[model samples]
Target: MSTAQRTAPAGADRTKHRKPPARRRPHRDQRWPASVFLSPWLIGVVALTLVPMAVSLYLSFTDYDLFSAPRWVGLRNYTDMLTEDPRFWRSVGTTVLYVVVAVPLKLGLALGVAMLLRSLVRGRAFYRSAFYAPSLLGASMSIALVWRALFNDGGSVTAVLDAVGLPADGWIGDPDLAVYVVVLLTVWQFGAPMVIFLAGLQQIPSTLYEAAAIDGAGRWRQFVSITVPMLSPVVFFNLVLEIINSFQVFTPAFVISGGNGGPADSTLFYTLYLYERGFTASHMGYAAAMAWLLLLAVGALTLILFRTARSWVFYADEEGR
Candidate 1:
């Protein structure tokens, strides 16, 4: 056979021995498992949260008294809220004051306690439980009632003040001080942030402190320079959370004020007033408008916090400072 014929036969033998290319199956859907797990939550959001928000938004633009059909009022509800409402403004002021005072005090106390707890070696769990117990019941009706009794005339707080030779009066009855009393209760529930702060503290590297110590830096200097920088993100988180929570304070004010927002409306938190307008005064439309405005205010505040956080919040994983 010729050399060309011999080469052709060799190529044919090689081709016959080679395996055919494996057939490729279509790509399997990997997102199915996640979608399956998320379907219930999505359903809940649509059925429970989103639907109610949509209804409330619609009611905000109309006069919706529960007894009668909703009447289209255009922007009257919002206009009245801004121009003609005194109680609304008072509630706004009260809520703002409560948030301003309570959030900072709460965070400060939380951080202090967290720092103390981190150094504790014995009975640490017990102390943590005791410190955190209040947050569990802080906003409950029973706690509010207990706080009211404790601050009322001849109550425990009044008696203590009297014993200390200080001015003793019913804290819940004074218009100028009733809001502060609510703020005090909020500050007392610092446990949640305390626990969060404790977690953040634990996450901090001990090597940083040791290195600073080797450089002759005092504890305070290390705390200010290393600790604060690392924990800034946690502080920012707790601050935003506490601010949002403080704005929505209602049960305590409602229970303490006997559902009337009494004592000249000093303890009239915005949510309490919204509840009063919607249920007590039968002005559902006005209440809905108030609720929407509150949502907007909180959203704005949260947005501002996020925008400002870029300048202060530090993440360990970030590069290029």
Candidate 2:
């Protein structure tokens, strides 16, 4: 045999070594079960969420009063909403104001309570559960009713205000201050965010505080320099959540205002107004337009917050600021 022939595999061995092209059918077959498992969720999204949103979008451009056929009028709803509806503007303003006032108050109270709970040497569980109890009610009608009962004119809250020597002129009905009652109720339910803040605070390293103390930093300085930076990401999270919830505030306004946006429309949150337009007045198309507008506004605000977070929010795992 030639040296080359000997160095290479014999013909029979070469035939045995030659492999067939890899089969992909088994891998493709393996994906079928995952697709099958995901089908229900995909079906639900399509049937429940996407379908309703699509119908709402289409309805937003038409005049559908729940009885007559939808009359297509391109951009009329949008144009009228922007140019003609005074109530739309009022609702927009009130919702924006509520978000601005309620979100910060809720976050501040929650963070403060969280820090307090963190420092407690005992009864942490009891304090956490007690503080979080109100949030467990969520936006239930009962909670709203209770809030109205407590804060209405001559109610317990008003009585307390009077005890403090603060003048009260129709607490829940005051056009100028009706919204603030809702804001107060929101602040009272700070438990959810407080729990989240407590969890975040727990993750912070104690060594950082010890080091700051060693460097001659006082409690306030340590908190500002170390605690705030480490806890910033949690703050951003609570901020976005509270802003969205504040804009959608309705049950409290509805129950408190007797299904009318509070006296003079001061508590006409965007969602409440949308509900009235759609269901009470049967202006479903207009309501749909308003709904889309609210969605866009929230999305814009959330986007702005996310952009703003780039400068302030910190993460332990991040390699760069």
lDDT of 2: 0.86
Clashing pairs in 2: none
lDDT of 2 at 134: 90
The Cα error of candidate 2 at residue 15, in Å, is: 22
lDDT (tens digit, per residue) of candidate 1 on 1-321: 588885455342245456333311111243577679999999999999999999999999999889999999999999999999999999999999889988999999999999999889888778888999999999798999998998888899989978998767877887887777788899999998999999999999899989999999998998899989999999999999989888998899998787888899988889999999999889899899999999999999999999999999988889566
Off by over 4 Å in 1: 1-37
Candidate 2 global Cα RMSD: 8.9
Candidate 1, clashing residue pairs? none
Worst 10-residue lDDT window for candidate 1 reads 19-28
**Candidate 1: count of backbone clashes, pairs at least 3 residues apart or interchain:** 0
lDDT of 2 by residue, 196-231 (tens): 999999999999999889999999999998889999
Q: How many clashing pairs does model 2 include?
A: 0
Best by lDDT: 1
TM per candidate: 0.88, 0.89
